[model samples]
Target chain A: MSQCLHQVAGPVWNLGRLNHVAIAVPDLGKAAAFYKDVLGAQVSEAVPLPEHGVSVVFVDLGNTKVELLHPLGKDSPIAGFLQKNKAGGMHHICIEVDNIKAALMDLKNKRIRSLSDEAKIGAHGKPVVFLHPKDCGGVLVELEEA
Target chain B: MSQCLHQVAGPVWNLGRLNHVAIAVPDLGKAAAFYKDVLGAQVSEAVPLPEHGVSVVFVDLGNTKVELLHPLGKDSPIAGFLQKNKAGGMHHICIEVDNIKAALMDLKNKRIRSLSDEAKIGAHGKPVVFLHPKDCGGVLVELEEA
Candidate 1:
């Protein structure tokens, strides 16, 4: 039944690999060290994205990544999250999509609300949009163009 | 200097791929549908683990998986997390390790406390140990034997 429906109305977009799981941390250096020295994963140097209001360090896990994020400015997006979760916590999960616009449109038609009306350049310099957590089982999901 | 130190101290264990990210959900069916019907991902049937006190549905994302967990029995570990986050949320991330015992020993030596003194048989039937969230930047990290 599903296959027949798919053949008839063909899916608009395709979901790709799991990009990275974002973690918000109060201490960026300690978090980076935890992945690099403690867990012994290859970690990238902390890259400050002032415009994005966060400093990110990518912890390479071979197949995927763990992005450690820290507040970079006064009005950082993750500031309130850090305030609520004092010690910091898992922030969001980014998943790759073949077509952001198609995915957004399809998701919108499915009543899945995006945080923004259109895709924006994400930290990875790819077009991305965050789906509302309320509609995603309280999980902030980022769909990035693959 | 780090390379020289690595040669001198040789890391005890190696961190492998990220196995899966676990999300605790209040409603198993709805969460499963969100990933399957909404996001169009390959989802598995919910498997009840009475001993583990949770029902799990694997959302295969190609590279890794999203384990959607719902409280099973009365003593479900995720029951409290669900109570706190009514809409459901990301619970823990499981990362594979080359040597579980060695990883636990090394982490213990580094003052990285595990929730239990020893590794236990996890839901996937692998030896797994959960590290203290406080020590892991408030992220509950599960180290599974690869």
Candidate 2:
């Protein structure tokens, strides 16, 4: 199995397609409008993800999506980010994968850390897990089930 | 020409496929090794882009690319980013466009500001322009000719 390991190790597991690039914005409405009215992009209705502590809107890019996230509550996760950066910025990126559990197992086996203990339902309504930003060169990487 | 304007305004510019997501790294070799050895990603040989003041390597993700950028000179654009983020992080994303000039014109007409007056040859060997981060909700966006 070492040869199989070697081949898979050339590029282990499936690094699937990029699902979306998430951007955190101070004002969801204004950001969405900027893309829609100015850039002529199709902006989706804002959906509140209370569990995730953010309200999100998707700007359809035809090929991919630009997700706009805003803090939903006083203790929202994005509140700290907004506090540090008055203006919004790119938050995280989601990459599609075949199996969340398998991916997690593989990453753990490689000593890669996951932000959470287990997978959770993400904005796409799919099982997802976040990799530690430190482990991902400061970029928050999210793996979602395809 | 109002009808023509309307046609162009309906997402007139084509937002082609995402070319690559660039991540600024403190140590290019270490970052490349992390992706290659740990993540099992096939990492390309690092190439120095003297004009851009950085050394870069691409990690093929099958669907897209992850570009690792390391500062090569004192005035490298990514130097300041790394100074603030000692651990390094996602820098900017490059999206493919059909006509760089046309896309710039469209963005300019809509009041979107580009970081430069003209397109420059980017690491991908394509004409590219970076949009002002403030104008793009704080995300530095690179538009490259398809």
Q: Pick the candidate with the highest lDDT.
A: 1
Which stretches in model 1 have alpha-carbon errors above 4 Å?
A1-11, B1-11
The lDDT of model 1 is 0.94
Q: Which digits, one per residue and each the tens of the lDDT, describe model 2 over residues B3-121? A: 45854664445667668888899988888987887666779999999988999998887667889999997799999999999998888878887778877877887678999989999
Give per-residue lDDT, candidate 2, residue A10.
Answer: 44
Off by over 4 Å in 2: A1-13, B1-12
lDDT of 1 by residue, A47-119 (tens): 9999899999999999999999999989999999999999999999999999998898778777899999999
Give the per-residue lDDT of model 2 (tens digit) for A42-103.
Answer: 78899999988999998776666778999997689889888887788888888888878877
The CAPRI class of candidate 2 is: acceptable
Q: For each candidate, what is chain B's TM-score?
A: 0.92, 0.91
Cα deviation of A113, candidate 2, in Å:
1.9
Q: Top TM-score: which candidate number?
A: 1
TM-score of each: 0.93, 0.86
lDDT of 2: 0.82
